[model samples]
Target: MRDFTVPAEAGLRDAGLGAGTTIALPSGRIAYAERGAGPPVVFVHGLLVNANLWRNVVPTVADAGFRCIAPDWPLGAHQVPMPAEADLTPYGVADLIAEFLDELDLTDVTVVANDTGGALTQILMANHPQRLGRVVLTPCDAFEAFFPEPYTPLPKLVRLPGASWLASRLLRLPVVRRRPWAFGWLAKHGIPGEILDSYLSPIHDSREIRRDARRFIAGVDKKYTLGAAESLTGFRKPVLLVRAADDRIFPAQLFERLSAILPDARLITVADCWSFVPEDQPGELARLIVDFATDRRADVVEEEHGC
Candidate 1:
């Protein structure tokens, strides 16, 4: 095992590690962690959580005759210094991701996206169809401006002045912050100290990133997502939808809409998974990813994807 070290000047040079590769994005250097040796399988995380969220899944895919690269965006837990005025919309963020992907010269990439990332991946697949090989989306909150019910509306509220402070404080409460007990799934990615520190410490370490919570909320573009869905539903690539039976954030009702658009796409549901199914079922997810990536190319046909 090698060490992945992150530093300011070295910038994207290391992730306390000597393996993998990194590159400079518009905002700053992107520290990409890589391992194993084989075909490229890029793992991208959603907002709030960085590559660490994929820690459990990296090796699973890597060990299975595939190369894995996990890139840390400057916006999130990596705490990259944001420009005083950055357009952090879904398209804006996807542009940076596209830039990162281009720099890596990664063509035919099997892109795996979760949560907000799933939406971004959809955008990438639609806009940059030629660059994509296959896609895997899971527990994603795509397609709908109004977020699913029973979610911490605070994520959107975090943009307001007093709202973020309220969130930081509220998250500290055991009663209020207890992992959803409705199902035992969230327990896998619960707020344990190490998990909390790995995800939150970077943002907490830098007071500047307090603005990120604001940026994260403001970045949500329901329009862009809807358009991406429009494009992705007709995307000419193999797509696998990993549905968590107990996802609390993304309403399952929308799955019907998703299926209508992605008619040829296969669906895999984890009966006992919460919002963070990738963390809970990394191996299963990894296998599905490999299968999706290697499957035959599917052509797009125009139709009103049962929205």
Candidate 2:
């Protein structure tokens, strides 16, 4: 049990994040950002991103009296590389999430996820829902849409040697990253240059980080989520699906399907946002999550518009 704390004023100035911390996990050192204190809320992000994705949302929820923990999972953008023998499969990632919660001894936690993180959360709920209190899923890969259609090229690209590494290098180019097929369509507004740099640098600079990215990409497919869906019915915890209304990648109809699939789940549509709701509508997203966590959903969740 170790804590690597970074001064809030200096460490995360670029991302406007909170105190950065890293804990030793069985697979490797997992980095995270935490703030405030109360009930625990863990955030999970997808591949090629890190805890910084929650920079805007964390403070709002943390200030609302919840201890927010956003870990930089080994999904490509993480600074720390996993052990050579680490399992990087989708189910393995879910196990890591469970282990992370157990390591911190956080029970009855609210788990929030976006993009690929949501897919991993589904597996966690299916296999390791004991420590989870509730779940909030934003727009993400669902059913058989693993990387979604436009981006399905990723899995195949990663199969070819050195392809993923080369693609990562191209992401360093601002113009390539913001192209519609890239991150351009994911958020209504572009992420700040510095923050984007932080998200891409790990894979661009380190072969080990790129290896982690390739391992994750190679494992992407709908079968993992399909299997998780079979067991989601047993997860009776409160569930909220906050789908981005304008997301071009993840279909809006999936949210409608998920509402019917989970016994305790409801759907909320966030307008003027794309797949990256945390960056596009952080305040509204945080308000919805806070309301859900506090069991005060009449106003926040009900105000949702049709997708």
Candidate 3:
């Protein structure tokens, strides 16, 4: 298995995410970082990103007396690839989350997710609600808009002959990734070079990684989310929906729609942020998570989710 440690230059430790660790799963070895020690809080990131997405938010929540576990799930940019024959579809990846929890013996966990991760969380809640305690979703793919608008073309791009390779090659240029239509829309501020490199290098260096990514892309569909929405309506567990005011990729109406669907959900809007709330509002995101987890009986919260 790969060492999977954060490089000294990346300075993840300084950002409060500490060193990396790995857990052996049937699919492959999963790399992760953990802090604090109490009822667990697991974080999930989206496509082309890793656990580093939560570098800032993890420690803040960890300091508040809860264990934080952030794993680099088998997205395109994960440092380690799943077994060659492993399934990389969205539902398959959702199963991986459930497997991770069962293997780690984590129970009644508060799952926090962003971007594509939120979509998976909805699936998990619908299909594997045994171990999860509650969930917090920051603007992500919902309903029949799995790929959203500007990004909807990605699935077809991955399916086109040699298109995945060409897309991977195009992504090699750092400048191209900084375009608004690219990863630039993910966060409101500039992403650090090292962090971005960590997210992009795996696919560049390994065909297997790219293969896994292509499979995930080909599996993207709104039906999975729509089905999850139906099951979610009956999900009585606590749910928190966080939306970024400045986000352009995911529609603002998603928060309201999701809140209305779930029997016990509250919506909060964070300003000056895009799709990635952890990057733009980690401090505020952390506070809301901790407060929600600690206060088990909060009267089915229906107030504004202000930071």
Largest lDDT belongs to which candidate?
2
lDDT of 1 by residue, 188-221 (tens): 5564455555555555556566676467666565
- The CA lDDT at 87 in model 2 is 89
Query: What are the models' TM-scores?
Result: 0.82, 0.93, 0.91
Model 3 misplaced stretches (Cα beyond 4 Å)? 1-15, 297-307
Give every collision pair in model 3: none
**Evaluation by TM-score, superior candidate among 1 and 3:** 3
* Model 2 CA lDDT for position 206: 87
Clashing pairs in 1: 3-16, 3-17, 4-15, 4-16, 4-17, 5-15, 5-16, 5-17
Q: Candidate 3 lDDT, tens digit per residue, 1-307?
A: 3355554334332347756677787777787877898889999999888888998899889988889998889988876678888878889999999989988989889999999999999999999999988899998999987979888888888888887777778787888998765787888886787778778877887898898899998899999999999999889889989989999899999888999989999899999999999998999999999998887534324333332
Tell me the whole-model lDDT of each prediction, alpha carbons only: 0.64, 0.86, 0.85
Report the lDDT of model 1 for residue 100.
Answer: 73
lDDT of 3 at 197: 78
lDDT of 2 by residue, 62-108 (tens): 99999998888999888778998898999989999999999999987
